[model samples]
Target chain A: MLGFVSGIDRDLLRQFERVSQQMERMMGLRGANGIRSGGVNAFPAVNLGASPEQVDVYVFVAGMDAEKLDISLQQNLLSISGERKAALPEDAQVYRNERFNGAFRRVVTLPEDIDPDQVNASYRDGVLHITVKRKEEAKPRQIQVN
Target chain B: MSENKHIEAQDQENSAMQARGEPESVMLPPVDIYEDANGFTLLADLPGVTRERLNIQVDGNDLTIEGEAAIDMPENMDALYADVASTRYQRRFTLSSELATDDIRAEMKDGVLTLRMPKRAELQPRKIEVSAG
Candidate 1:
């Protein structure tokens, strides 16, 4: 024991050091695709905009593979499901892990009526871009009066 | 006061024996530092921090990354299963003077934290035109 170490001070420092080290191993934050989670939607960073041509949806999901992606459309609701595989190596011993794994689902309400059949989704560089074509009936038709 | 100090010294000797080594590892989130035309982009791994829990403070050129990571372990489980009780991370980095601290922006996705520090207008490359008489 160092001369400066006191029982109370030693315990306090031990806890502080433990906490500080724990802070170092947080691999990443846990998040859901779109649904409300713990009072807050995982990202809540989706951009909401509707134009005449198509509806563009950008969902941020880094470190995820395309094979694990699942997108479904129910009426005006769009649900996305996938998983982010842990980045750790299989053979390595894990001292600590902070990233959430398993399953995730997010449901987004479409701003405009969309043709589910014509929707297209692509995942590239960690972002899931979904293009939902607007239904013909939902598009504005210019009407001329005499 | 002298008596208390003597007792405390003895107590410290015991504590020292209990805690004598460094933590296994001092790992941090994956960070990518890039310099672009606009400014610098810092991408860090911040697994358990939510937007509300994230705190960013830039005073002068000192950049601080402070955030709380809440663990998701259930309380009622008596049986043991594989687990990693790791949560919480904090780190700090110094910023360049050319960066616009006021215009810095951060966004988190999945477990990655992206920080964009835009360069000040004065630091931007501007083409100068010469008048021909």
Candidate 2:
């Protein structure tokens, strides 16, 4: 009887391992598409805010040329993509490296009230600021009592 | 040459904070260090930090980098979402006697800080010529 119980336990453990492997692969597929999976260690972290008139997005990235950054908006989806060159020389001996390099893209979905045609972007001090104006109909108005 | 005796990174508080299960008050910026025949180059990514807010100090053999980032929020704007908590960045390092601390060059551009620390003139690698006797 003990031998049969142990065999059942081994089988259950193997099933758990298989499920975990599949879960890892699913997460990897989501990360490869540059979609924010709410991972704490995502590259080029961002902060988002909104006001009555406009929405603001703050992207934090360093050592990048502003002209090379690509920003586009389709409906309510905003995409920011760019490539960061390596900082060190090819022949130099490296001691430590913690910086992110290579190509990176971040996609953010905005609210439906945003006006895609009224967007402005600016880069300053390694931070990119994107502001999108809200539609006139979406603005909050104080209703007067009759 | 086998060991890193010239420069060593030190961050005791950051580790202690993690151990104590407390939130970090200051952020540790990512860095890259590379060595060449002449000297060592240190690059740090300090996003949102401007030149006027950055401070670098070398006291004895201790090197410290401190900076503050200002998040510009327009008046009467509500922050719907925020991932970054702290805007302060700080890191420390210990330098060896072989480095020329007095002659270190620093440059800040696009929220990145580059420090070039050269070796002492006498400690630089030199090639010896073999002459026929």
- Restricting to chain A, the TM-score for each candidate equals 0.61, 0.73
Which 10 successive residues of model 2 chain B have the least lDDT summed? B2-11
In candidate 1 the C-alpha lDDT for residue B44 amounts to: 65
Model 1 CA deviation exceeding 4 Å by range: A1-146, B1-27, B78-85, B127-133
Report iRMS values in order. Answer: 15.2, 1.2
Q: Candidate 1 overall Cα lDDT vs. reference?
A: 0.63
**Docking quality class, candidate 1:** incorrect
Query: What is candidate 2's lDDT per residue for B9-126, written digit by digit as tens?
Result: 2246656667899855888888999989889898998988998999999998999999999778878787665556689999998887789999999899888999999999999999
lDDT tens readout by residue for model 1, B60-101: 999888666543322432211111233445677888888999
Candidate 1 chain A has its poorest 10 consecutive residues by lDDT at: A32-41
Off by over 4 Å in 2: A1-35, B1-24, B129-133
In model 1, the Cα lDDT at residue A126 comes to: 49
